[model samples]
Target: MVKESKLLPRPEFQRRLVWSRDDKNHFLDSVLRGYPFPEIYFADGDVNLETGEGTQLLVDGLQRVSTLIQYFDGDDNLKLTSAPTYRALNEDEKKAFLQYDVAVRDLGGISKEEIIEVFKRLNATKYSLLDIEINNAVYAGALKTFCEQIAEKDFFRAHNIFNASDYKRMGDLRYVLSLVGTMVQGYFNRDDAFENLLDRYNDEFPMHAEISGRLQNIFDFIEECGFDPKTRAWKKADLFTLLIELDQVLHIRNERLQPSKVLEELTSFYDGVDSSGVNQGSVSSIYYKAALQASNDKINRVRRGAIIGGILLELSESEIREKLRVEGLA
Candidate 1:
């Protein structure tokens, strides 16, 4: 109830709601089963010494409290393991639920930075969201907004470039940002390259919008070229490489691109790779893993971009050829 009060504002710093339905259901199940929850931390505020009224800001556990309030109010359609909803509970169930004690540690007059630190320390999990989601929360400016536009586009849905969870977790948005970031910076580093670009999004907010526009144009070109859906070109490293290279050179091309031809060339390139000493069975996974790893390396990024450029050059695509020459690339 205090959460709804404007006197205590906790929305100043909070993680994105990336919890899955299953995760919420599991938590709700545990609550209904009388299991104890972890201590939720709060920042203490000033109080009226006489009336004993004061405001407290939540430092952590927003999701948990949100889920509880949502379930009790029968607002969200959460699948319950034990009962329908808090409102559906019997008198005894209601009494037990109300009587259930939740642990809380309130720090008086905590600084905002200290509260954010506490919040981060508490949510250290595989779903800890130290990447795009967290960054989006802190920098809820143009970058986050542009990412939303890209993720919500019909092109991504129709092409299956990214899914619902990818959107929720900001994976798809990060992928596009990574490609654009790599191309714009003229290099790809195995470490910190992506991180540095994301941090710059706060200041380079307008650039993200321009990049989004170019990206949409590139996707349109890919579809116009007739890329085969069976090639799964819409996913992973191949798509990343293709998009980066196309954005660099295709804008100035006088002729249209042939997606089927590009797919065929790419497929042939993969099929003809030599794995002389690689073991059979699951060992092929090593090569697959290596290809993915190369997707981030400086040398490999240049190589992959050059491969696409070479193909276009062969077809008298002078724009790609000129780009390679000017960039001092093969």
Candidate 2:
């Protein structure tokens, strides 16, 4: 038979019963309504020989037990009122909890000197808990939260953009932020510029707000750029090129790209492309040269081609070609 002792909270535990009153009451109500709950695991404590009582404290599973006691005692306020009730009874109600049979395995036989070795071995096992490095590097806090918000919003549901499992993995907020940081490095002056950008958001900068608004516009514009859902491959170079061109058109400096004007310019560019067979391949090269006349460097010509193609697909080829010819791109 399992020995029953009142389990106390340990100081080293990361979390306490931090749930709000409503949250606690709702959880207790669900339990009182006969809703089944999963069994909780606890690490047993050592017994005090002089007192003949075990220093039983919780290692895990504090929340469920706390909820049960709160509701049973009619403490609707859901406060941590008193010590937990741990009775050694064979009653049906108790059986629902104790039937799992808590066995007290003696770790007392193991010397303190060998404890570290044992801990290392156990932790290195396949089912071991996640290390801090793995958690931080593979799954960062910001990326995780961002992904969760996206999933909760059902952003990809209509498009089936990402698989459910893929969404879960990508939800690591840190990784997503890192990728965005890499893309936006050109606009920031400092090495840790992304960190500063996050600080700006937290600080409520107006420019940051404008940039966020523009990002949403950009996402919408990409969809209009003939992104293939089945193949999952977009006209990558063209998308970047158009974004750069639109940035120039709007006179958006550094990272402060305005969404409203960017969208209007994108639509205008698309509406200007000609579709006549007289200038198919030449159309992309022509518009590209015209759009990039400010820099007009020969190195970026190949990249300009794809952007021109995207414009052709969206607009009339003749109009764009005529403008390019007038600008000396023909």
Candidate 3:
């Protein structure tokens, strides 16, 4: 025969009430409307028994059970009443709830440890909770909120420039922030000091607001560079080389090292190569050599010719010959 047990809350189980407002409302509406729901399971133990008679402690489905009790007995407001309502339940109401026959199943005298293991497996399988999303949602303080905002607006658009598969593989928005941080650090005197100053400024003044703006401009420039913006197929190594050339050009041309100048130079380089009918496989190779020579103030005629020659080697002989004659490289 099936052993009959009373519905009770477990003392050891603290109710976390993790359900969102929408989730709670929908659950309550379903129950009140007599809509069928999946059977609520409970992991029975000494904790449930210790709470004594009349007051049934919930082992699982605390939010659902609590919602029902509150709606039926207390105020119908349903906004998870802040004041304690459980202790105020009268004798008749308490008896009615206790007598409420919920389908109860026993684990056939399973050990406490075994029961816990079963409970964990059941919850894990049922919810399909993502640990990272849960952690971010649960402790969603200031930084997490800021990160989420950046991701939704800036990161989402920027990442979509690549193919869908590549974007998903890149993981979260933090990686993009880290890359931007790396670039920002390159401009300052002391990297740590700059980071500290930025953090302090963000805390006091609203200077960090510019970060989102800067990121938008950066992505815009990347789009104009003729590389597939969505897949970011330009490659990180290529970007690094391009950044070096951009920095050099900005310094030499007495231009501000801002997003606009960066974009202009990047677009110009690609346009120049395309117009010249240069068949260099990777523009990065040319930019790398140019950056190296520019850094040493060795960008003279001879050095330029040598760099151009190296770039041409990557092209077919006929194409290189034609490009050489056109550019006076012959």
Worst 10 residues of 2 by lDDT: 129-138
Instruction: Judging by TM-score, tell me the better candidate of 1 and 3.
Output: 1
Q: Is candidate 1 or candidate 2 better by TM-score?
A: 1
Give per-residue CA lDDT, model 2, range 21-122, as digits (tens): 666656544453456554444444566789967644443345556665554554546553232233522477555543433333234434323433443344
The candidate that wins on TM-score is 1
Off by over 4 Å in 2: 1-97, 102-155, 170-175, 186-208, 234-330
- lDDT agreement of model 1 with the native: 0.65
lDDT of 1 by residue, 149-228 (tens): 76677876887887666766667767766666665687566545655665677565767656777788888877776666
Residue-wise C-alpha lDDT for candidate 3, range 26-110, written one tens digit per residue: 8755543446666655544444456653333343455666666655665555664333343466786556545555554455445
- Candidate 2 yields a Cα-based lDDT of 0.42
Model number with the top lDDT: 1
Model 2: lDDT of residue 96: 54
Ranking by TM-score: 1, 2, 3
Each candidate structure's TM-score, on Cα atoms with residue i matched to residue i, is 0.74, 0.33, 0.30
